[model samples]
Target: MSLNPIPNQIILLLLESYNLGANINLAILMSLIWNDLFLLFLSVRNIIVFFGPSPTLTKPLRL
Candidate 1:
C-alpha cells in the first residue's frame, strides 16, 4: 500500500477535497492491483509471444 502520495492526494482532492481514509484505501488498491496485474500481464505476455498461448495462463483470466 505504498505509492507516491502526490497522485493519491491529487485524486482525493479532485474526488472530495482530500480525505485521509480514502487516500489510504486508494494506496491499498494500487498495491493490490499492481501485484495482481504484474503477474497477470507477465504471464500473458510470455504465453502469447514465447509459448504461443496455452491454458497455463488462462487459469487467472478474469478479464
Candidate 2:
C-alpha cells in the first residue's frame, strides 16, 4: 500500500515551514497552514465518498 499524493504534498509543505524557522513571515506561514487544513478536509471527504456510510445488519450478498 502507498500513501496518498495529497498527504505527501502536505508533509513537504510542513517540512518547508520548519526550514523557514525564525525568519519565517507570518503571512506565508498562515497561508500554508490554511492550505494544509484544506487538504486534510478534502482527503477525509474523499475517504467518506469512496467508502460510503458504515454497514448495517443487512444480509451479505453473494456475487
Residue-by-residue lDDT tens digits, candidate 1, 37-58: 9999998898779866568666
Which residue runs of candidate 1 sit more than 4 Å off their true CA positions? 1-18, 52-63
Question: What is the lDDT of every predicted structure here?
Answer: 0.84, 0.83
Task: Summarize candidate 2's per-residue lDDT along 1-63 as a digit string, tens digits.
Answer: 987999989999998888777346767788899999999999999998898866653457668
Model number with the top lDDT: 1
| Superposition TM-score, candidate 1 onto the true structure | 0.45
Query: lDDT score, residue 30, model 2?
Result: 85
TM-score winner: 2
